[model samples]
Every structure is written in C-alpha cells, then in structure tokens.
Target: MKQFQNNSLYYDVDVKIIKQSEHCIFYEMRNDEGKGSIKSYQVFPGIKLTYNDFHMGQCPYHNPLHKDILEINHCREGRFECNFINGMYTYLGEGDLAVNTMVNNRIIDSTFPLEHYHGVSILIDLEDAAKMISPILKDISIDLYILRDKLCAGDRCFIIRAKNSIQHIFSELYTIPDEVKYGYFKLKVLELLLFLSIIDTSEQFEKRTYFQKNQVNKIKQIKQFLTQHIEYHFTLKELSKRFDISLNSMNSCFKAVYGIPIYAYIRTYRMQVAASMLLQSQYSITVIAGNVGYENSSKFASAFKAVMHISPSTYRKSH
Candidate 1:
C-alpha cells in the first residue's frame, strides 16, 4: 500500500497493490473518508478492467497515467462527470457507456456525486491492442489502432448507446463468483473486443462529438458563478450575454460538458445545498427551500422529488 496527495481536491488517496504479475496486476484504492474502494485489474500489456464501488466525495483532477490508453466506461449505479484535457466534460449516468482518450499522459478530470458510485471501466492501449488484434487486421479494414487514431484522432470521446451485448458483458462481471473470475474476466475482455470490432461501420466511428478546451473552461466558470449565487436565477439569454456567446452554442456546449441543460445543473446544485442545510441546520423546510432558491414550498417539493425521489422532511428525518 502507498499514499499520495491528489492535487485536484487536496486529499490523500491510498492504494494497495494486491498482486503484480506479467500478465495481470491487481490493486485497490481508497480515500481518507473510507468512502471509496476501487478494485482494478491490469491485464497484460494492453488492457485493464476496473470495478468502482466507492463514495470518494469529490475526487481531484488527475491525468491518465498510461500511454496510448483508450477507455470505455459504464456507470452501473450512480452518475459522474469526466473532464478531458481539452476542458470538455461528459456525464456518465446509470446505463450510459462511453469511449474516450487523449493519447498520452494528458490530464483528465473526474467528479463524483456525493454518494456511492458503482461502475466498470475497460481500458485498452492502442499500440498493444493493435498488435494483439493483428491476426484479424488482414480481413477487416478497421484496425483498433487505426480505429483509435482516426476515430479519436484528437482529444475525442464518444457516448455509445449501451447495447444488449455491452450490458451482458458487464453484468457478468458484476456477478461472476470469485472462483472463476479470472477466467471469466479474460473471456469477457475478448467478448468486448469482438463486440467493438463488429458493431460499427468505418463512418459510424466518427459520428460522436467533442467540445473545445476554452469552451469547457467557460462552462466551468459559469458553474462556479452559479454556485456562488445559488439564490439568483439566470436565463439562457442572460448567460449567453454574460459569456458573450451565441444562445445555441451555449446550450450545446453546456449540455456536452455537464450532461444537462444549464437550469438542470442549477436545480441539482440547489437541491444538494438544500439537502446539506436540511441535515446540518435548524432551518424550517420552507426556509431551507427559500434559501436554496425556491420561492414556493410546493414547487420546491416537486423539484426535489424529481431529483431525490423523496420529500425534504423524509430525507431530513432519515439522515
């Protein structure tokens, strides 16, 4: 086990390497709050699989450590955000699957909601992956290397629709017993590769979208602005004028980065703040809702129920 300071959130992270072999390396990660336990398996020269069952409050920003690594992520239980080197962010909600990479050691930021997040990740090294699949390259036009380079050529990402095949592969991983996990693990990786190899046409690989670093940063600034002024409401036109961007561009960019419209992000943040107040303060429900930017209790309750699935009083009492 070893310890390191995560620069992004200024928190300590602990890692325990359970095994390190030429074919596979197994490890686990936890944060100081005991809210996280992420198990990882690095398979040989090219592939890695991770199962995340943790609640690391707000994980700090960090770059991918591998060279030429490409990631496929599926969120099984909770949602989070993935920030790329180019400043863009993607949301990984339950059942959402995505592939992303920026080639090398460039930084990628991550944010987790304030609860347990369970997910699975599969990473592939382009060069090594290409070599492993060389035997099949002679017949197919889409080499994994070519697929990565041409498809992701730049700081790129794709939110793939979760098909039954991908879902089945991960569902098995979640349920496989310890006795045969290793063999099943290898089989699943092969199955995943096979699925990727045949699922898309050459052009379909290029269909995904990405955002710019400056644009992403702009949205981040807007998020900070909203956080600081939670009681105040801003409209799309107001935000666009404030940021000196077009309305359509702002909407698209904001959705691309944060995975929701601007107002949805605001409401989510407001409810989260309301939740904290409910637990930590003696404020009345109406007062708490007002403090979090709601003018009417009924409206607040409806909105809260939409995101939290419970009434404020119930949530407060339960906690």
Candidate 2:
C-alpha cells in the first residue's frame, strides 16, 4: 500500500492505495477541512477522484476544477446542500448518492467535520466507461433521456449498499491473512460490479418509457458518432445511409430518446460547445461559431439566441 499525506486547508489530504490492477484501483482518502482533494488514477485512464470536506460552522465555497468529472458522492452521514450551476439546491441526507455531471458550474456545502461527514466516490473515464458498457450504452442513454432530471431514492439506496460492501471488504484486508485477502478482494470487486450492473438495470426499468435494448444501442452509436464529428454538417439522409436506417426511422429514434430531432440536437450541441469556448477561451465570436461547425456567424448567433433567449455576445459577457 502507498500512502500520501498533507496538512493544509487548500491542499491537505491523505490517500492510501490499498490495491491496484491494470483495469482498476482501490483507494481511500481523508480530505482537509474547507479544501478540495483531487487525484487522477492510472487504473482507468482519464478518470479522477475528488473529495471535499467542510468543517462545521463553515460553508463550503465553490472551487472550480476544470475537468469533466462525474461526481458520485455516497453520503456516509450528515446533511448537506448541493448547489448546482442551474441555481438548483438539493438536500442530501445520510445514505444518499449525489451524481453531479461536471458540465458547467456546481458546489457542495457541508456543516460537518471532515472525518464526521465522509463519502466514497468513483469516477469512471468517460471513453473507457463507454467502451466497458458499450453493449448496453444505448439502453442507458435512452433510460437517461426518459428519466431526465429525476433521481429516485431507491437508486441511492442501491448505490449505498454497494459502496458499503466494498468498504467492508477493504476493512477486512488487514485482519485477514494476506493470501486470503487477495482472493476475497477479487471476489468483493466482482460482487460490486455485479451489484452496479443490477442497479443500472433497475434504474433503466424504472425510468425508461420504451426499453428496446437493441434500438437503444443503435441510437447510442449514432449519438457517439455525431458527438465525435460535431464540426461536420450531417444530414438525416447521410446519417441514415451510414447507419443503414431510413431517414424517418433515424429521426424518430432520436426524438423518442432525446425529446429532440437530430438537427435540433446538433444545433444545441454546437451552441453548447460555443458557449464553453466563449467562457474558457480567448477565441473571437466568428472563430468560435466556425469551430462549432457554423459556417455563418449570423446563423449561429440566431440559433443560439433561439434556444438561450439571449444573444451570444450577451451570454458571453454575462458569464
């Protein structure tokens, strides 16, 4: 086991890598009060784990770590407020799991000590995770669309149970003989994966309106292709030809799953990309528009305004 420790609110934290393999790493950490802790993992490239702790009587401040992190917080104990970029605040109780997609802006507030309020977090590399779940990615995407913006408490319970099971396995590692620990740890990890798979399935069944696994998978592939080539103008006919589906069928699939047409999704994706560039880069309006596949700056501005209700220039200025 490798151990790392520090002692500063801005940087103080300790991590112990209990076990590691080619595909996954098992680690634990204690974060500093009023500070955020972030660590990247080689086990799953492109994935990182971050932990933040807030002392009682102090409110957690917003600390921006510029990366697309999928935060999974399993609140071991205590109450906290999750403040999102959209100005929505969620109250998280003990045994709750908070999934935050690091898209725009977000923060967490806790009125408890670092040790008192603890949680386990797992960050799966987006591309790697996509490949690992490729067989079911489309179904998951469709389920996400149907479940949009609602998290059931039962889902949280399932996640908590899985987390605890993993923790329990870790806790026994030292007590048990080293030879037994290896075998038991492997078993526990397999069990955890199976539990996660079951949770994913349950969430899908509970949330999705239509659950055609095969069709959903195809839609996922299309979405992935579009995301990869967002700069290129893609027509329904072109996409249909490439995916071997009729134009009508392609459009219907997208609409049924995402509640939007393919063109609308592309336009929205372009605007979102442009918005990010405007906030994070020094690129000019015309350059940003063209970078996101908009040939005409005026056309891009018009489409952005239609969805956002604000001009691109104004939006950039405000953010």
TM-score winner among the candidates? Answer: 1
Please, what are the lDDT tens digits per residue for candidate 2 over residues 1-319? 1311211221213434445554334444444443322332332233333333333423334333443434455554544444333333344445555454544443433233112444444444344444544354444432221221233232221123224644553344335574564455445433434444445534433222222445545665888798788779977888888888777667765665444678887778778888899899999999998898888999989988998889999998998
Model 1 TM-score is: 0.72
Which tens-of-lDDT digit does each residue in 264-310 have in candidate 1?
A: 98999899899899999999999988888889999999998898999
Q: What does the lDDT read for residue 153 in candidate 2?
A: 33
C-alpha positional error of residue 315 in candidate 2 after TM-score superposition, expressed in Å:
1.2
Candidate 1: the clashing residue pairs are 86-213
Model 2, residue 161: C-alpha shift (Å): 33
Itemize residue pairs with steric clashes in candidate 2. Answer: none
Mark the 10 consecutive residues where model 1 has the least summed lDDT.
Answer: 1-10
Q: What lDDT does candidate 2 reach at residue 115?
A: 27
